[model samples]
Target: MKINVMTDILEANDRIAAVNRQLFDSHKNLVLNLMSSPGAGKTMLLEKTAQALRGKLRLGVIVGDVETARDKERLEKYDLPVVQLNTGSACHLDANMIASALPHVDLTNIDVLVIENVGNLVCPAEFRVGEDFKIMILSVTEGDEKPLKYPLMFRESSLLLINKIDLLKYTNFNLDEAKANARKVNPNIEIVDISCVTGEGISDWAAWLSGCYKRKFGTNSLA
Candidate 1:
């Protein structure tokens, strides 16, 4: 006989995640789990999002990393309530981590909560943190084969942000192929091309976020 440790861990996490989902729903919060590989521009995109939706939406953030508050520090200047979770050796942020951090953030004060999961294409996709959507970023410099290489990440995500598109000329990343591959894995996944550095597509991303918030809150206006 053998113990299925991984199965047990996931089952435990799912139970916590369900509880978290109820709390978020009660607060009318639109939660998003943002995942990406290291250097894929997750922080930059969040920074841009903060700037874009400043007056329109009240945002909250949970920054997760192996051992740093650097990302948390970066978003604090935006005046958003940010909680930093240093996961130590954990490669992914499990539901228990989010449930523990919830007390640090006032869910009622935020229109949306974005959890920046530890920068990994693999483990992050395997865990559910009670998010309304799982959004992943793949930078052009990382190449187009990422969707195929990390099929589960694509399959699990609701949206695929093709980041660093301004640097496309410098890299051989094929946008068409990347979208095709992502669609192959997740047919309904929304794809958006963006550049945090150039400010391209930030409005579109913000609009999408606002739409989700409005839908969750049952409001007709973002204001």
Candidate 2:
């Protein structure tokens, strides 16, 4: 009975996700669902990405958190349209939560819509939020064995951002081993190393994201 109930829930979620996908397709916008564990730098990456793509892309952000509006406030500094979805005590953001926030965003004018899912490595990956791609961020501080311990996020994501590289010297994290484990689970996952503090490897990440947007929307410039 429990298994059946869980399946039904996912089926319903998928139907709603399809509707959201159609809405985004009609507006010619690319939606990216970003997932990560708590304090994995998802908000910081969004801030940096928004800043880097400023003027080049009509970007909008939808931040999901269990309660506070902290992430939304950080995104607002980019001066772009953003909505905050406080899920109360929910551990993850689902398609329904995203649908509820759609009314506050101008989807037609937005070239890229980034949904920063509630900071979680597990359940977020299990739910589809009507995104063209899923990107996951893993901080070196989270340990190198995360890929093996929590393989689902790495397996589900199209891109992985290995963040906090600036702290690598202070930790015993093995970059190669982490990448190897992730590849074993998902061989085609595109990995980009970045450090929000030092602004390292951000250009590559931005360029890749731009390419993805172009591939999905068919134009190079979001403007």
Candidate 3:
């Protein structure tokens, strides 16, 4: 009975997600769903991305958290259209929540919309919020066993950013092993090593994102 209820809920959410996807597609917005555990550098990556892609791609963000609008506050300085979605008790942002927030954003103004999902690896991966891609961030300090333990997150993600590589010497996190483990679950997952602190790999990440936008819209002009 419990499983049936959960299944029904997901079905409903997927239907809403389809609607959201259709709306984004009509506006030619490349939406990215960013997922990670707490302190995995999701917001930092966005900060760097906003800086890197500024004046290149018009950007919008939907920050999702369980309670406070702290993350939303952090991103407001960029002067982009930023919307905060406080789930209250929900661990993940569903399609309905995203649909509710859509009115707050001008979809016609932005080329890319990044949805920063609640800082959770498990539940966030299970829900689709009408994103073009599911991008995961795994900080090196979190250890390499995550892919093996949380296989679903790895499998569902289109790209995985191994962040905080600047602290590689201080931590015992093995980069090779981590990549190996991630590929074990997701053979075709694109992985990039990045450090938001030193600004490493931010350009590569931005280029990849831009490439996605270009591929989708088939235009060189981001603006």
Candidate 4:
């Protein structure tokens, strides 16, 4: 009975997600769902990506967290359309939450929408929130075993950003092992090493994002 209920919930969520995807497609907006554990620098990466891609593409963000609007506050400096969804106690964001937040942002004017899912490696990957790509970030501080232990996020993501390389020397994390495990799960996942603090590899990440945008909307990104 429990399994059937869970399956039904996911099916319903997928139906809403398909609707959301169609809405985004109609507006020519490329939506990226960003997920990571707590303290993995998801917000910081967005700040840097926003700066890197500013003017090149019109951006909007949907910040999802269990509580508090702190992440939304940090992103408000950009003055772009921002929506904060506080799930209260939910560990992850779902398609319904995203569908609720879409009305708050002007989807017609935004070229790309970044949905920052609540900090969790498990449930977030199970739910699709109408995104073009799921970009997962794993800080070197989180250790190399994460990809093997939390294989779903690694496998489900289209791109993986190994963040916080500045602390790589201090920590015992192995870049090779991390890449090997991630590649084992997702053979085609595009992985990039990034440090949001020092601004390392931000351009590559931003370029990949913009490339998706240009490919989706063509040369004229006025949409």
- Give per-candidate clash totals: 0, 0, 0, 0
lDDT to native, each model? 0.91, 0.90, 0.93, 0.91
Give the per-residue lDDT digits (tens) of candidate 2, residues 1-223: 3454445758888998999999999998889999999999988898888888878888899999999888888888889889999999889999898899999999988888999998888899988989999999999999988988988889999999999999999999999998999999899999999999999999999899789878877898755
Q: Give the TM-score of candidate 1.
A: 0.95
Output the lDDT of residue 19, model 3. Answer: 98
Every model: Cα RMSD to truth: 2.2, 2.3, 2.5, 2.4
lDDT per residue for candidate 3 within 164-219, as digits (tens), equals 99999999999999999999999999999999999999999999998999999999
Candidate 1 wrongly placed segments (more than 4 Å): 1-9, 220-223
RMSD of 1: 2.2
Q: Candidate 2, residue 194: CA error in Å?
A: 0.5
Alpha-carbon shift of residue 74 in model 2 (angstroms): 1.5
lDDT of 1: 0.91
- The lowest-lDDT stretch of 10 consecutive residues in candidate 2 is 1-10
What TM-score would every model get versus the actual structure?
A: 0.95, 0.95, 0.95, 0.94
Query: What residue runs in model 4 are displaced by over 4 Å at the alpha carbon?
Result: 1-9
By lDDT, the better pick of 2 and 3 is 3
lDDT of 4 by residue, 1-223 (tens): 3454335658889999999999999988999999999999999998887788777888889999999999889999977788999999899999999999888889988888999999999999999989999999999999999988999999999999999999999999999999999999899999999999999999999888877878877764553
